[model samples]
Target: MSKEFEIVREFEVDASPEQVWEAVTAGTGGWMWPMEEPEPREGGKGPFGSTVTAWDPPHRYVNRVENVEDIAEQSANQLDYTIEPREGGKRAWVRYVHSGILVEDWDNQYDAADKHTDFYLHTLREYLTRFAGRPVAFATFEDGPEASKSAAAFTAVGRALGLADDTAEGAKVRARGPEGQAFDAVVDYRNPYFIGLRTDTALIRLFGRNHWGYPVGISVHDFAPDADGKANETAWRGWLDGVFSA
Candidate 1:
C-alpha cells in the first residue's frame, strides 16, 4: 500500500483579510501560478485542471486535483487555504495544507512539495505587501532540470542579484544573468525567506531554498503581462541551465 503525506504551513501577513482573500480567490491583486484565475465556485475549474471543492469568501478555499496532466493515473492531491483576521484586522493569518498520496518515491515527492510550499507562501506575502489591488500577469515555463539540481542553481542566481544579507526595502537592484539577460528593479521586500523586486514594468521575486535535500533550484516570479513572456522564459531557462551545469 502507498503511504499518505500531508504538508502544512502557517504564517501571518500585515494585510486585511479582505485584501488577502481577493488576492487568493479573484487574483485581483496577485496570483501564485502563471495561469488565468479560476472561477470562485464549488466545482469551478482551477489551475492545473483542479476543481474547487470549497469556496468561502475571505475565510477558506479548497482545491482538489483529481486529474493531472501526466501523473493523473498515479497520484491524488488537494490544497486548502484558510485565512483569518489578526492584529485587530490590520493583518491576516494564513494556514495552507497540501495533502496527497505517493504511489512511489514518497520521500522525494514529499520533500519537493514541502520546500515549494514554503516558497509559494512567502510569495503570497510578497504579493499582499507590494502589489495588492493591482492587475498582474504570469507566464511559467517548464522543462527545466529536476528539483534537486535546480535549487543550487537558484542560490547562485540570488548571489548574482546581490540578495545575500541585504534586507533593505526600496534598495536599487541590477543583475545580469547569462547571455546578457538582466533585471533592473527596486527591492520591494526582503527577508531570509524570499526577495521581491519591482521594475518599471514588472515585479520579480526570487527564492533560494533546498528542494528535496539538494540545493539545486531557484524559482523566479515575473509579474508582468507583456508579449515578451515566451522570449523571456526561453532565455531564463537557458541561463539557469547553464548556471546549474557549470
Candidate 2:
C-alpha cells in the first residue's frame, strides 16, 4: 500500500534568508550531497531529474520529480523551501517540507527519512554558520562492512572516537582517527542517531543508521580551498574499516 508522508522543519538559523537560499539551491554539497546548481528560473532542471515548479530567490523554491522510470516505489517527490528574514535581516526563519509517497515498508522508510531530515538540516546550519559560500570537497563512504549492520555499531564507533555516551553538543572534543588523523573539533550537533563535528576545515557527519536496521555510514565536507574529495574518501574509508575491524 502506498502511503503519503510529509516531513516538515521550521527553524531559525544564523544566516540571512539569501544565504539560506544559496545553501539549499547551489551549496548543498557543503552539508548534504553534492547537488548541481539549479537554474534560477521556473521550469528549470532540479536535482534528481526534478523540475523546478517555483523559483523565488531568497524566499521560496520548489521542485518536483514524477514517475521516473528507474526510481521504484516512488511515484512522485517534491521539495519546498521557504525562507523568511529575521533579526532585521541578519538571520533566517526557514521552512523545509519534503512530501512523497512510499509503497513498501512505509513505517521504517519514513522513520529513517524523518531522522535524516534532522541531521541534514543541522548540517545546513553548520555550513551557514561557519563555511558559508566556501568551496566544498564532499566525500561519502557508503560501503560499510557487515559489522556496521549490528545495533551496537554506532556505540562501538563512539567508543572508538572517544565520545562519551553523555557527550553533548558544543563540547570541545579531541580524538584521533583510526589512521592517526587528528580531530580537534567542537561538537556541532548531537542526537542519539547522529553526531556532527565541526573543525576548522571540515564538517564530519556520523550517521547511525544501524538503529534503523541499516549499515552505519560517514560523510565529510571539506571546505578548504584545495580540499581533495577522493583523498578524503580514501582516508575516511581506512578510518571506517579500522574502526569496524577492531
Candidate 3:
C-alpha cells in the first residue's frame, strides 16, 4: 500500500543564491550528513544515486530516483530546490519541495518527515549565518536500547544537559555532558522535538525522536579543521550510554 506525499516549504535566509546552491549540492555536511557531491548538470549524478532532472546554477535544481528497494517499494522520490537572491544578493529565498511515496507506516513516516524538514531548514540557516564554507565532520548517536523504549528518553537527555522546556533560542548555555564533555554554546534552534546548539566549532542537534516512537538521536556537525567524525561519534555514544544508565 504505497502512498504519495509532498512537502513544500518556502523560507528566506541570509545567504546569497550561490551560497544556497553550494550548500544544497556540495556543503550538506554542515547541516545534514555528508552526501555524494552532485554533478552540476542535468542528467548527471545526484545524492543517493538519484539522477539530476534539472540543474540551473544558483537558481534551480531537481533530482529524482525510482525504485530504491531499501528506501521505497516501487516509488518515485524527488527533491526540488529553487533559490532566488534578495537584498542585492546578500540573502536568498528558497523553495524546497520533497515529493515521494511511502510504502508502509505512512502516517508515522509523514509526521517524521514534516517535522524533520523544519529542523533541517533551521539548521541550514544557522550554517549559512555562522559557519558557511567551513568543512564539517558529521556524526550521529542514538539512545541506548533501554532508553529508546522510554517515553521520556529525550526529556531525560535534556535534563542531563541542563535544558529547561522553555530554553529560548540564542540563549547562552554552559553544560557538561554525562562524560564531562563541556558545551559553551548558544541555543540556535529549539522545538518540542528538536534542539540545536551552536558552539565555536560545532552545530549539535538533539532529536526527541522518542516522541515519534523512535530512539532519541544526536547529530554533530563539527567544523574545526581537525575535527574527526569517528572520535565525535565515539564520545557522544559514551555520553548517551552514561545518560541512559544513570
Judge candidate 3 against the unseen true structure and give its global Cα lDDT, from 0 to 1: 0.85
Model 2 CA deviation exceeding 4 Å by range? 68-73
Instruction: Give the TM-score of each candidate.
Output: 0.73, 0.94, 0.94
Model 1 vs. true fold: TM: 0.73
Tens digit of lDDT per residue, candidate 1, span 51-154? 88988888988987765567632377888989999988999999989987777777777766676677667668877886677656554444455542443555
For model 2, the local distance difference test gives 0.86
Q: Which pairs of residues have clashing backbones in candidate 3?
A: none
Query: What does the lDDT read for residue 132 in candidate 1?
Result: 75
Clashing pairs in 2: none
* Residue pairs with backbone atoms closer than 3 Å in model 1 (clashes): 149-216, 150-216, 150-217, 151-215, 151-216, 151-217, 152-215, 152-216, 152-217
**What lDDT does the true structure give each of the candidates?**
0.67, 0.86, 0.85
| Candidate that beats the other on TM-score, 2 or 3, i.e. the better one | 2
The candidate scoring highest on TM-score is 2
Candidate 3, residues 70-181: lDDT per residue as tens digits?
6543377899999998999999999999998888888888898889999999999989898999888999866555675577777777777888877888899996664686
| lDDT of candidate 3 at residue 130, scale 0 to 100 | 89
Winner on TM-score (1 vs 3): 3
TM-score of 3: 0.94
